[model samples]
Target: MDYTATLNSMGQGLCYALVSILFIFLAKKLDDWRTKNFDDDRHIDDGNLAVGLRRAGLYLGIAIGMIGALSGESAGFRTDMLYLLVDGVLITGCLFFSRFINDFVMMGNMNNDRECVKVFILGDGRTVTGNTALGTVEAGMYIATGFILNGSMSGSGGSFVQSLGSALLFFVLGQFVLLGFGLVYEMITPFNLRDEIKQNNPAAGIALAGILIALGIILKASLSGPFTGWVNDIVGFFVYTLFGMILLIGFNALVDRFLLPTTNIATEIKEDKNVAAMVLVQATIIAVALIIAHAI
Candidate 1:
């Protein structure tokens, strides 16, 4: 073993750790500042899962988006830092915008910012507040964007500009794919998913969130690997995304038929608001996504 190389590796890891900590700290502060409606610290202390989950998503997103930049061959310290900076800004900005897109589009008319945390007035006129079920869906969007960025930014074959453009394009594509999937899911479900979420149904939210994040994972794989050419890369992205979607749909069917054949999956999630059923579905979907991500 070369002691010199080992020391170099250790130093690089330490540097990465420090940079990651700083990014997370700033992401937290930025998210809190934008929330505007409630004291994040206070709401978290009061057991607001909605606020907490939203916060966690950003945290997780920052971490996930950093994976590609942190890994791979270092192009000298200065170049690595430059790459990290550019990709970091893109990841952060896209995630911030992702919230609005998800809220306005897939959510179908629900306002996540307004619903995630709300203020209520009691008979005594004292105000109280808590996170709503919508927070989970927002959290999913954050994490999913992170994954898409990770894919777009991964690999070392492209020019920096090319890679950056790929990242942006894939980010947009990921959102559209997610929106498409949402429509398809809506078509299959017997109930109105957006309505259930509006009624504060956690199960409905969980199921939707699961599929979003799982698809994000798959897209990460789809976008990843060596960048061949613009045309090749774009074609490859769509092809992989289509394959991933098919696999995801197939697994959902499997879960419904074999994994939990006794119950109506829709009834459990939409009617009974069965968190456990949704959790199981989510777990199965994520498990399958992990396998596909690894294979890709």
Candidate 2:
């Protein structure tokens, strides 16, 4: 065995161990803060805020480390490190900003008595299951992977328009995959899948699948041309849908189980005619943000 190789491996192991310890310490601190200000009604928002702060801090630290490493490394290391730093900063910033916006919107909705939560298309009030979150994450992972591949496959001096179109096509394909998996899971589950779809019944799932697949094909077509265009209209739809569903169900459950049926403003808004309109507006904003993100 090469002594130099062994020493290098030990150094890398120490670096990872230190990073892990720092993460653990940060998690412990955040947990303590949450316990100190624990209010059942506002737990989700508080937790989100804590997570956002921690993520921002972690990313910033990582970015700084990358920059430092790049400053003292070979050209190849410098190039790779710079990419890592930029990507880290972008991801962390997006996450923190999104969480902040979501929290603000949630609070505003509560104050205005609007219903922002719907678990499924059927408007069933169920908390978001782990399966749903995993599905969404998996879709996101695939979309990102596709984007990286698109960039790599684009030959030297590739058009930005072509690259962007390719990324969007991949993203829509990822969404279709997610919906397909969800449909399959629904069919295999013990519960009636028909009850899960909105007004259209089980056929609704089939309809949605068809629509997404068609959109994916359209995106693929758009990428074929030079001008570059997006085929998918419903960007970040799944994430927001899951979030709204989980949040609404969890909040309603808390109120029903713990608080008395007080004639409060928030409760009144839940039943108001304007609640659905508010949800539509929120959904539109989310869609726009997602589109802009992809474009950038």
Candidate 3:
């Protein structure tokens, strides 16, 4: 064992850690412009530590993903550092653009806005306003997006220009598939997602979060296949994404009937604000995702 090589590698790891932390700080700033209803200052002022911590988790996830993508190919220190910065910036930009599309184009502010605290009208006609699960959902989405895109971009060894093109293509196609899934979810559900979330329904938020993560898992699996042409790869991703959606829907239907026979998840979430039920719903979604991820 060469001590010199070992020490050098340790130093490099420390440097990467420092730079990754910096990138996380910068990524959070970049995401700030697109994030809605997640006012950091307000949350902090109101002593809502959960919201603040979730935001950190989201940004850190993005940074870590970018760092992982930028690493693994041996190169000079300066060149690697430059690539890391560029990868972080580009990935962050892609995420921000996706959020813009989801918020402005897809949601259209019709879902009653994505605020942390929402007013819920109970069955007894009582209006209760308080913090909701959107914060957790938002954080989950960012982390899931990072996981998907990072996994897609990894190991596609190429020049900066080639890598950038692939990243852009994957990002656009992935967002498109995700939007389609959202529409399908809306169609199958009994109530409007936006309205439910606006009513401070954490159950809705959890379900959506689970779907996003599941899709990300699906996308990662689809993209990790053999390197084919751009057209073939994109088309293949769409097909796999659809299959994943079907699997998710089917699993949910079965669970709704069999897993907890007495509990109607949707009603419990919408009318009862059953946080435990919501957590179970999320767990089911993620469990399916993990199973698919492993199978793929």
Candidate 4:
């Protein structure tokens, strides 16, 4: 092993650690402002530390991936540092844009305390309200998008302006994919997602969450970076992404038809509020995502 090379790597790792902390702090401040204005619940207020950490963790993950992608073997500390700051800020913006789409376009945060029924009240009036795990699955959606975006931006090799354009285009493309998925989900269901969530329907929330995460998992492969300078490279990227998403949808439909012929997932979720059935759907979605991701 080369001692000098090892030392240099360690130094770069330290810089990454410091920058990650800064990114998380900045994201939290923005999240705080969002909570204050929009009535978005803070994970801390509900004592769900996992949710809080997951949000910050996604930011850190994106920053690290971006830095690694941009910092070539020959790049020095200063060049890498510059890449880190610029990419970090852009990725953070991506995070914010995702939040906007979820809240406004998807109506994710439509109602909190206003329409939510205490879980205990629905049952035997026990003291313990069951964990709805509300907001958790949606948060997973953000994290999955982060992973995809990070991969897409890697090895971009373009000028900063070109990279920025590419990143923005990819972001819009990602949102459209998500939107298309949500619309399909809504069409299949009797009840609207926002209304279901508002009424404290855990089944609806969990299944939707699974769908988003699974789509992200499969899409990550399509976003695998190192894009070339050729115009065909850009065209191929979009084509592959659409192909992956469509294939996943078809695969999911087959699973529903063949794996559980008698079961109606949407009705079970909307009418029965069957958490176990929802879990089964979630599991299938994840299983498919894992298989596809591995194949890719």
The model with the greatest lDDT is 1
Give model 2's TM-score versus the native structure.
0.26
| Estimated TM-score for each candidate | 0.93, 0.26, 0.84, 0.78
lDDT (10s digit) by residue, model 3, range 1-296: 99999999888777777776777777667555544546665755776533563565467557746755665566877777777777777777766665556555445453313354445566689764443555555555666677667766675555667666776788777777777787787788887876775555667777776777777877777776544667777788878887888998888788777766887767876677777776787688787888897798
Sort by TM-score, best first.
Answer: 1, 3, 4, 2
Candidate topping TM-score:
1
lDDT of 2 by residue, 67-155 (tens): 22222223353454444344333333332332233223312222111111213232565443112221222222222222222222222
- The deviation in Å at residue 208 for candidate 3 is 0.9
Residue 264 accuracy (lDDT) in model 4: 73
How many backbone clashes are present in model 1?
0
Against the true structure, what is every candidate's RMSD?
3.0, 16.1, 3.4, 4.0
Better of 2 and 4 by TM-score: 4
Candidate 3, after superposition: displacement of residue 187 in Å?
0.9
Regions of model 1 farther than 4 Å from truth: 119-132
Poorest 10 consecutive residues by lDDT, candidate 4:
111-120
Task: Give one digit per residue, the lDDT tens place, for model 1 in 139-253.
Answer: 8888988998888888778788988888888889888988898789777878888887776777888988898899999989888788898888889988988898889888898
What lDDT would each prediction earn against the true structure? 0.83, 0.33, 0.68, 0.64
Q: At residue 208, what lDDT does model 3 achieve?
A: 73
How far out, in Å, is residue 99 in model 2? 4.6
